[model samples]
Target: MPTEVLHRLSTLSLTSVKQLGRLPRLSSSLPALPAPRPTLAASEVPTLFREPHILSGYRPAGQPWSSYLLSTFQWHNESMNVWTHLLAAPLLLLRCWSLLEGAGGPWRLLGDVAALPLVLYVVSALTYLACSVAAHLLQSRSELTHYSVFFLDYVGVAVYQYGCALGHYFYGSEPRWRDDILGGLMGAVYLPSAALLAWMSCACCCFAKAHYRRPYPPRRKVVQLIPTGLAYVLDISPVAHRLLVAGDWQRDDDGALGFHAAQVVFFMMAAMFFSYPFPECCLPGHCDIIGHAHQLFHFFLALCTVCQLEALFRDFLARRAAILDVHGGELVVGAGVSFFVLVLCCLATAVWMRRTVQKRLKDQQA
Candidate 1:
């Protein structure tokens, strides 16, 4: 057979070794391989790895007091909310310092004359700090926590208002407790009245929590106290009016508060302004926006600060004009503390109002 024909026949027959087979040339082609991966050892793994399910990690409820306090700085809704008021405590301390330094020489002699007002200020600051932190942290924890913290917040407010009244009483000549006939009787009514309101609010909150097995609403008590506190604040206007009758100046056993009815009246009005829980009056969602009841309360509180300052200035001037000699430093300190507190309360009110409004609006849209 011809060579080509033989080659074809051999290739086709699968017997090409003799007729058509030839050695093959090899190329660089090879099988693919995977890249090497790094391995992790049990010891090399982080402690967090042992608990794989704890991606977020469950934090126990009974966190330490210091931990809870430090937690305010972390990523929580109340982080900013909590610190805002906590900052006020230090600011008040600073005010106390400034007040001491600014007070004239004659004022320093009275030992702890400011004890009541100062104590009130401290309690108010502490109560607010606790309320702010507790409300911020616990309100979201559980239903019980929510109600407890909320009641505490109201109690803080009541204490703050009562402190304002107490501060004013310090400037007056009458002892908070005088058993001298009309003086004693007045003290009996006024002092106990304020105390009773505070106690009732606290009691109601406690009773509601314990007996009702629910969050007690302090709204009714607040409603009752609003008018009563306002009346008490207004009733003191007679004193202010009496001061006015004595001309633009009058002297008390201690010093002189400005006798101008305008100034005194302004101060009295501020107290009345703070007496009401304006936060409750807001039409649910509306005030939650830019002008909530809390904000209004803050504004009134701020106004009280300004008014008190004005009253203080008037008092100082009157004292200067009268050439009277008495230490009024405590009163000044009390006022300064109140002013700082007023600013803090105002800021809190603003923030809360913003949150409330945002929440309401989102709810509506949803």
Candidate 2:
């Protein structure tokens, strides 16, 4: 009787374990996602959804949000635009995950305050990539959604430009250049004005987008790119100075120079396509579904960002000892303060821009 009783209890224990294992499977069997929506031509969607020379393969506006999410897997005018940054976001995260947990291991990172800027840079890069992904994916839902998401996208760009300024200024810069004048933005407060430029550029872009019609004219293009270009020039100052004026290119001790040069080249190439539409402008509807300039633009921009991160990471490591000596514990305070200020400013700017977008959208509807 004792043996039988023990045997029954053992069987019940085994059964309970098996049931617990099965529970996970049951829990994981979630409802299936929506299937991809049927795509439309440029003519099918309203003019607001259309892009010049992109004659086909637009997702119909007002799809359930799920359909837009599912469209990530399907082909459309925005597929590469969605994927280039979507895939890159995870890749960037994967590359930076170890660093976030502490670059010199968790313990060493506690003392290495200089790693702060790199951490901020990583977070900013991820923010921009995620925003770009959201913008490309959901921008087709409605006029309001289109404006709203893209406004957020511009905010992301502003954040990222400030981040790039941080990484380049601290890690990649020549110290002599750091002392130069720009509204006494010396030390960690470097480029506060540049941040304003970026913020104002977002406002400029929003205004252009609101007022301009599809197939934006040269005037609209100028309004969009002029301030943005100026911001780019200022934000890129450190790297540009290092590569051009400081002659950092002549030194190849860490392979950072190569990566830096590659980033510049890739970014300029991508920016050209972003501005002009290039061969797509020449080919038009023939290139709509498969090979479009915007698609190539997305690809090259991803590559540029990857190269930028690579170079900046290399520089951070190579200059760590010097950074620690020159900056001391100020590394934590300086980087933290600057990033905090930038976030506050960006959030404020985005909120103001959102209100403007809402007003414009309401006016359009009315």
**CA lDDT scores, all candidates in order:** 0.41, 0.74
Clashes of each: 1, 0
Q: What is the C-alpha RMSD of each candidate to the true structure, in Å?
A: 29.8, 12.8
Error of 2 at 316 (Å): 0.8
- List the candidates' TM-scores in order: 0.44, 0.83
| Residue ranges of candidate 1 with Cα displaced over 4 Å | 1-84, 104-122, 129-133, 173-184, 204-291, 299-366
Candidate 2 — which pairs collide?
A: none
What is the RMSD, in Å, between candidate 1 and the native fold over all Cα?
29.8
Once fitted onto the true fold, the runs of candidate 2 whose alpha carbons sit more than 4 angstroms away are 1-37, 97-103, 180-189, 364-366
- Per-residue error for 216 in candidate 1, Å, reads 11
Query: Compared to the true structure, candidate 1 yields what TM-score?
Result: 0.44
